[model samples]
Target: MKTLVVYYSLEGNTKEAAEKIASSIGSDIMELVPVKDIPKKGLMKFIHGGSGATMGKGTELQPYTKDASSYDAIVIGTPVWAGKPCTALNQFLSDLSSTEKVIGAFAFAGGSADKCLSFLREKYPSIKYTVSLADRNSKKLAPENGSKLSAFIEELKSELISN
Candidate 1:
């Protein structure tokens, strides 16, 4: 069994959390980039995410550094912007064809109740969901939370292995 961590990090907060999650369970990582990358400023990127756009900037999709289908489970990570998953994951979601695999959605953000949770649900209706929280500015996560993420990943693996 294999795992993939495919995520978009505007201010690197999500990436930090992703690294923690991946550390708990060995998994290869992929970073999603639009043709034009967003600035590292979290506030401005947050504005762009809520703009109600189908896709953003040149939209040059980075080639799948790793095949999304090869993994037994995939964890999609992004920061909550105006309470929605960044557009990058939403863009990537449409590319995948359902294969009855373990898909999990996790979002990192400092504020907003249920931030990005609804957007992830709207975009990937089929995925099983779990979320994590972190400070947007500091971008540091507690180690124990990675254990929470690890538990989630383990549960998915067990279910997949059982079948």
Candidate 2:
């Protein structure tokens, strides 16, 4: 079955995990980038945060040519910022509505994993399956993250195939 790994990576933490997930499942990858770059640090970051501040309402930002409809399953990932998925991911996800898409998610956070998972679960109630992967820092991937994420993806794949 076709799968898409869509994610928003800040400081590459999320990207590292996303890459592993893609390779494990052979899923196409899509990196979610803001049309406007974010400040790596400083007061500007505190003020605008990320995508929430710059993205236009319903902004598509970096568009992709793939037919999302072709994917039998979709996995999403994001870095947690201040106990939530980065603002950009939140804005971007707001565009999706109920369809028959099979969905899964993994989140990377500096420390607290609960907060990001709570937010995403509430936001995307339609998601069929979900997972959360976090590390203590935003700069690096969690140890053994690739193995853990791949295991979950494999489970999802098995279920899809059985059905």
Candidate 3:
């Protein structure tokens, strides 16, 4: 199956994870870039990012080259902000035109990602698989989280075979 990994990253954690997943599964990857991004560093980042996430806002996105609907499976990655996906990812999901493809999701968070993962599942019922990485900014691709990522990839491979 042709799979696509789509993600948004502010601090590069989500991007790193997406790259790893794409490499492991031999899938194409795409980044979601917002036209007007929040402050990347400083107190304003927390204030703006947290409030935007809590309010479930979707920002305007830059035009992307990939045709997401062409992929058979889609894996979305995002950083957890205020226990929700980032605004860029929210915008991508909102703008997506197809829902019939198989969907999977991954999230990077400072701590627990339960709420973030739950929110994705609740909002997008088509998402069939998910994984969360804790403290991603500090220990991205560390040995501890390797097994979880491997398992996620394996599950996706199995899902593709079944489909």
Q: Give candidate 3's error at residue 47 in angstroms.
A: 1.1
* Per-residue accuracy of model 3 over 95-120 as CA lDDT, tens digit each: 78885463899998887677899899
List lDDT for all candidates, in order.
Answer: 0.66, 0.67, 0.86
**Per-model TM-score on C-alpha atoms:** 0.74, 0.76, 0.92
Model 1, global lDDT: 0.66
Task: Tell me the lDDT of model 2 at 65.
Answer: 43
Query: Mind giving the per-residue lDDT tens digits that candidate 2 earns over 12-120?
Result: 7778878887887778988877777568778776455543533323334566545566677677887766566676566556654533463777887666566667666
Could you give me the TM-score of model 1 versus the true structure?
0.74
Q: Would you list the rank order by TM-score, best first?
A: 3, 2, 1
Candidate number with greatest lDDT: 3
Better of 1 and 3 by lDDT: 3
Give per-model CA RMSD: 3.7, 3.6, 2.0
- Which ranges of candidate 2 are over 4 A from the true structure? 50-60, 97-102, 136-141, 144-147
The local lDDT score (0 to 100) that residue 66 gets in candidate 2 is: 56
Best by TM-score: 3
